[model samples]
Target: MRKEIFSKKIMDWYQANHRNLPWRKTTEPYKIWLSEIILQQTRVAQGLPYYERFVGAFPDVLDLAKAPVQKVLRLWQGLGYYTRARNLHRCAKLVVRDFEGHFPNSFEGLKKLPGIGPYTAAAIASIAFREPVGVVDGNVFRVLARIFGIDKDIASDAGKKYFFSLANELLDEAHPDIFNQAVMEFGALHCLPKNPKCDGCTFSKQCEANQKDLQSLLPVKHKKLKIRTRYFYYFIVRDKNKMLLKQRNGKDIWQGLYDFYLIETSRRKKTAEVVKTDAILTKASILKESRVFRHLLSHQKLLVKFVELKLHSTKEMNLLARRSELKKFTKPEISNLPKPILIDRYLKANP
Candidate 1:
């Protein structure tokens, strides 16, 4: 009876005032999956266009699977977290190859796919497949914690277990899709992370945090992110019309994306010191060195320098060819190469 009342009030509120988003109109798993992936860690306003662009570029799963990884990365350039784009591409191929282009129907099957964690699986399952599981994103976490006055640290394993059980119990079994949307939308629109509208909320009388005046203290976060800084010296190796770029490989950030011949260091090195001591830079004449351009990521801060260099002889080109990472490209091909947004900014400014 309590769950039914809560769901009734939420569904009423939703009908009166839910934002008409593009994804809300579709039940197709492909579109729903794309929206969920794109909106991960991204605000709706920022991610909206990217979703539209992706849908426009790759109309279906097969199109995404067939499209070049570079094209996908290029489309995903400004959006940080290249790993998501890679997984999106990989999942598309998997769906075509393994599932015969159909998304898995069961929650257990959906969770097995790469990048389809609990929240995403629940989201796609409920919105696209009408599964009864609850979706507990940051917004949902805030709403649930405040309503129930749950002070368990959301960053902990125990808190997740508690909330997952609570969320499932609170779900409206009859209309789980509508129930899930209402709760998530309620969190987004009314029960915000900070300064939520508890006074005007319909659940105010039933809300434990409101009755106890512990709204801000309910959703506890114990973890602190350690943001490290990295110094990257990038060489814009120019042989007149041609330039050099390297595909980022290995397990580092921005893997599979194109980058300049980079020399990472523990600390910032002086331009004169690098020019005089570095083996490759000594052979090339330094055309110019740019000021420090800072690119901020969630976990790391990149202090980057774009060092423009010119080759003295055809013999000097052999040194660059010896490098496995370095590959020469004409101006047109360089434009086609999918690079990190940090490198893209330098190219645009220099061009």
Candidate 2:
């Protein structure tokens, strides 16, 4: 009975009112998986162009798998959360090698992929394969909590478990694709984070949040973020017209992106400390001017200090010659070449 109502109302609404997204037109699991990954830390508006770009560049799993990691990273530049790109590349290769360039159809099989967790696996399984699995993303969580009047803190482990169980129970097996899309679409379009359109909402009649005048309070989440400040001194070394850049090597942010040679300190360092740091500047033969900038992340505050060094010769520094030459190097280029951001900023400020 409940299933019938859910199907009749939500599925009907979905068929008539679903947004015209590119990924919705096909049941290609690879494409769906790619969209899901790209849309994870990104919004629909921002991710759509990147999705189109990736699809155009590598039309198939085999193409994505065969492409170099650097090429993939270059395409994924400015998207942030670069580990997602790395994992996607790794997963693509694994799919090609083991699954013959086909995305795994089963939830367990999908889970075995490099970056796919339960939510992603369930999303691909249900949407791509019409499995009975339910996708409980942030949108679904909000909609469910409001509809069911669940007041548990969504951030807690117990609350999440309860929500997952409830979602599984509410999932309509007959039309998993339409059901999944409908719920997510409803939340995204109507049951939003703020000022939900309860008047137009299909579930407004029975929505506990609306009835209790607690629409904004239904999806309870307590954020506990530990924000840390980091100071980075980037050395932009140049010889003649070419500037020096280097690939970031670590398990932190901008892992595959390009940056200048960095000298990180516990606290913000002065110009004297930056100039006198012999160990840090040993790589560069000559020193020019130091410029400073700041780039912020979700939980990180980066105080970027740029020190432009004029190299005696390009022979020892292993740097790119011209701006055009920097285009040829990708993620792997990080290992051998320097980044453009550091050089661009240095030239902009100094020259």
Candidate 3:
């Protein structure tokens, strides 16, 4: 039944309706690999322009391998999940140094590269090389769970193993890319998170979830996320035209973006107290005023306080090497410098 279902309906629907993305036009393993990595945790519209910019800047593996890590981070600045950028840089260098500037063709070889996990490796192998391997992701999980009426929690280890096995069994041997894309496209377009369009769906006739009237309840997820709240006090210290800024260093969010001198508090602090704290006033002679702002992430809530200080001496703010060069520098540029979402807001407000 699965084989028949694939041979007739899904494949035909995919060929007719799949979106013509730029990545689909090429068989170049490097290009395909780059697209896959960029699209991770990024939407098609947002990722598409970055993909074009990256390909234009570094057309080949060797070009990316040789480019500075800071430049790569700058290109990837707004995308969020900065680890993807770091991994991409590392993987490119690996390909050039170890694989002769060519992306590994086989699944095993592809998996050896940094950040090439199971799904990514499968995608590169099947989409670029046409290898007979299944690419199972969230979209696939939703489609398969509803189609087969599997109630196991997708977040569980056992459930993941079961789905991968089923995906492997159902993958079409003749055209793995088309088959994989078809199921994923169906899930993305029709079988959505809310108010799914099930009436005219190709699989409606045979879909077990539809027959049982459980369209929204089949794919169970068990993971619960704990959001942590953080307090940030950023010094917008300026002497005449120059403001103080520094490159963030350490293993935390916004690993390679530029930010002002920061003071993290245990909880939200009052405005008068925020300005009076030793961390805030030690570097500046006078504080004109302070502005309070808040920024939110998927798992974080940040309360930011911006202290606008007119410094006694610009040299005290050591992060700014040359005070005269402040106007020449552009705000919010994507570089290896650490950029939290709050920094972006500050740039937009100040720019």
Candidate 4:
């Protein structure tokens, strides 16, 4: 029954070539969920070490639930998308408080938790608990779309539904755990988005897209991303060896993460233009107007410029400081503080 549509050769390839990751070795649902969350917006190579660190530090779901939010955010620093970390912490607490520190055994139950969406729940349910469900992440979507020559825009709801139905048909329920993993791994390693090695691929002969020479063009997306351009003016205000660091609050990226004094503008402003509007810049000594750092987000392009300001006295710095907007961190303390990648880059180079 399993052999009708499911590929046995892909399982063989998975057994032979799958990376020996730490999370894969564990049968614990907590560890599996942790790995999935870390790898959500992250890559395998970059996420592996963070996974190991998290597993070691928390050790159990109970530990993670009891740990401070700051501690969790610090551990998750530099991972980007701080919301994942926050939700992970929140989910842990909910599990502890509601479910008695046990993850939900079923996909629907898992989705009720803070950050466990359909893809994540499916991965955890099938891989950890042997539930008969298939994951349809970006990798899985790519694999199914290419092998079956599916030309529908995968980003659409209809396309996702069609692919999920096809995936359900191909899933070997008796071996759901290995089947889902194999399909995702096949996409990640062999049925690549770019230049896939179709000549050596096990499914090359049977693959529809490969036969049609349309692997690169098959998995289409309907909506073009609307990338907005933003300008940020960062003031690195320093009084002696102490500098101001502020925690990002409100509905914005890098919440719970620390960064320097920030002033966001609709358009990039020249130093002369910025100085005329603000009296502080006219009084404070502008050390250097650093080079513009271009940062690319999923839907935004940020052009950032850093200006270092040195005050004459401690009183002068204190007078200008907005306690709500700033907190002073010593030179040594700055190194210990976790910051966004943009700020971190500037610190390392300048120091």
Candidate 5:
């Protein structure tokens, strides 16, 4: 198909059927950048509220830069991939300190910001600054691969470059922003990964995958993620209204988040085995043991168990805290600290 025809059809479809997202209504680079980052690896339905909350709390780059990282993380509690929240704060600070609170106007300049990669930079450039660049995301990759019958593995660097080049070639330079939004929207709404609506599609006849009955086969991704199983035994040492909590400082999952005293093992252990493994656990009075909680991440499966312990004396509490290298936090204070979703869920369930 002709490049102009392809872009025109996409734009027409988008004009008729596009969802009215708030970010699409503005040309502000800051808002656009925030929306782009929030929507990364996140669906519109789930990410919309977060975007709104962030905008409400930190209205601009300067506000975000000035806000404390813990406050930012608290706002971003349930949203997994905590690194995004950290980077969002870092990016805001960089824009304020280095760029004078103004987001760079060009793609190259935007790329220098933290968490703004090629796709994000292109999105900010085209949508906010009217830079003629193509935005290649998962939706775009699937749409282009099926329509063009290109079976390159989307996970590979070569496949990414190929699709990006194709998107740029088909870009409507005069209205690159609209064109990019249209194609991405079309891919999201129509050309789905499973059960795509091809009967009423604009390019059903010309779509290579549709004609060849290879809809499920195109947009091939060869990489298979290896899942690792971990066992986490949490000691919830509590006194009256406060609990002992520790901040994760290691280069591991849930960094910068608060949780209880953790004893990770190669295999799941019973309460007795856990108690025998630690001197503090042996001395502390066991209040209750939680049922095993199974949590799954992108590549990690966790079998988590919580052992609640109560201290009868302040001396015992202090000793437990000192031995475990944990600090006491009241319920109100614990509520404000950022924590892993598993920790949050366990707290809510136990409380």
Candidate 6:
């Protein structure tokens, strides 16, 4: 297909049908970068409020850089992939300290910042800086593969290279920002992964997938994720109005988020089996036990049980805290502390 014709069709469709998102209306690199990062592994509907909240709290790069990490993570609560929030904070500081609060204007320069990969850099460069580059996200990948009929495993390095080259080849050099957005939006709205709207598509006749009836087959992605099952027994030790909570450390899931005294086991264990795992819990009074919560992540399946235990005196609470390496937090204090969604949801329902 002719690059001009292809780009023109996409841009025309975009101008008429694109959603009016706040990020699309601006040329500020900071806001653009924020939107891109939030939208990663997230849908537009889910990421929209987070973008608004982040902008409301920290309007610019310097504001984000100077704010406490806890504050950032707090604002980023309930949004999974906590690493993105951490990286967003780090990148903001790098931009402020190194680039004087101004994001790098070019793709290569933006790629130097932490968490800014090639796709993010390309997006910021084209949308904010008007660099002539195409952004190949999942949306773009599906669009290109189906429309152009290129059958390469999107997970493979060779497949990625081919699509990357094709994206640059089809890029509208004069208006890359519009072309990129148009194509991405086209795929998101029209050429869906499951049931694509092929009836009224602009490229209905030209699309290989539409003609060949293979929309689901193209854009082949082979992902081998080893889903590990984990069992968590969380002890919610409470002393009157306060509860003992511990911040997760080390390189594991929910790092830095606050949760209760946890006892992890190889498999599912009963309450008696769990109590035997920790000696500190033997001193406390077991009050209630929550039903099992089956939480699913991309690569992990967690079966969690929260056990509520009440300590008789402040001294006992202190002893539990000392032995368990936790701290006492009032109800209000616990509300302010960052927590994993599982912990937060359990608290909201139980409290």
Q: Which candidate has the top score in lDDT?
A: 6
Score candidate 4 by TM-score against the native: 0.67
Q: What is the Cα-based TM-score of model 5?
A: 0.67
- Per-residue lDDT tens digits for candidate 3, residues 1-351, read 566675468778888888999989998999999999998866788899999999999999999999999999999989988999999999999988987998888888899889899889989999999998898888889988988899998999899989988888988978888888788888787788677788988888788888898888979888688889998887676655555676665887777667776778888877557657664255455454446676778998887877676666645544333431222133334333456667777766765
- TM-scores for every candidate against the unseen true structure: 0.66, 0.66, 0.66, 0.67, 0.67, 0.67
Write down the TM-score for model 3: 0.66
Worst 10 residues of 5 by lDDT: 276-285
- Where is the poorest 10-residue window by lDDT in model 1? 316-325
Off by over 4 Å in 4: 1-5, 225-351
| lDDT (0 to 1) per candidate | 0.87, 0.78, 0.80, 0.86, 0.91, 0.92
Badly placed stretches (over 4 Å) of model 5 are 225-351
lDDT of 5 by residue, 1-351 (tens): 889889888899999999999999899999999999998999999999999999999989899999999999999889788999999999999989988999999899999888999999999999999999999999999999998899998998899899999999999999989999998898889999999999989998889999999998988999788999999999888788888999998889999999999999998768888788877678778888889999999999999999888767778888878887899999999999999999999989878
Worst 10-residue lDDT window for candidate 4 reads 1-10
Lowest-sum lDDT 10-residue window in model 3: 323-332
Candidate 5 or 3, higher lDDT: 5
Report the C-alpha lDDT of model 1 over 172-211, residue by residue, as the tens digit: 8777888888988898899887888987889899898889
* Distance from true location, Cα of 243 in model 2, Å: 46
Global lDDT for candidate 5?
Answer: 0.91
Clashes of each: 0, 4, 10, 0, 0, 0
lDDT of 3 at 235: 67
lDDT of 3 at 180: 83
